[model samples]
Target: MAEIVNLRQARKQKARDEKLRVAEQNRALHGRSKAERQRDRLIADKAEKFVASHRLDPSGKDEQ
Candidate 1:
């Protein structure tokens, strides 16, 4: 005996699975924890301060 399957339901299920897979990948790539965000912010702040400290003034005098 041959089994009968609904093609429309199968297509929808496949699409749903693909969507979930993509969503999971996106979460892994783009999601960040609170601690991670804080660490990134701290690193950026340090870099900005370091650059500012080393930057020369427009009048060619080192700004203190």
Candidate 2:
């Protein structure tokens, strides 16, 4: 025999779960300090520059 469930309660629980998920994500993204964020930005920028420097040009001529 299948157990009966209340649709209204289930819907409310689902909404609560979704809200909690979003809140957790927001905390992770916004919890960092200014210095920590700046450090991460600097590291990302350095990695981007490094990759760009090593990338090859599609055309035959080398870009000055």
Using TM-score as the measure, which candidate wins?
1
Clashing pairs in 2: none
The runs of at least 3 residues in candidate 2 whose Cα sits more than 4 Å from the true structure, single-residue gaps closed, are: 33-64
Q: Count residue pairs with overlapping backbones in model 2.
A: 0
lDDT of 2 by residue, 1-64 (tens): 9999999999999999999999999998888889998999999999988877777863446867
> What tens digits encode model 1's per-residue C-alpha lDDT throughout 1-64?
8899899999999999999999999999999999999999999999988887787763556656
- In terms of lDDT, model 1 sits at 0.90
TM per model? Answer: 0.68, 0.49
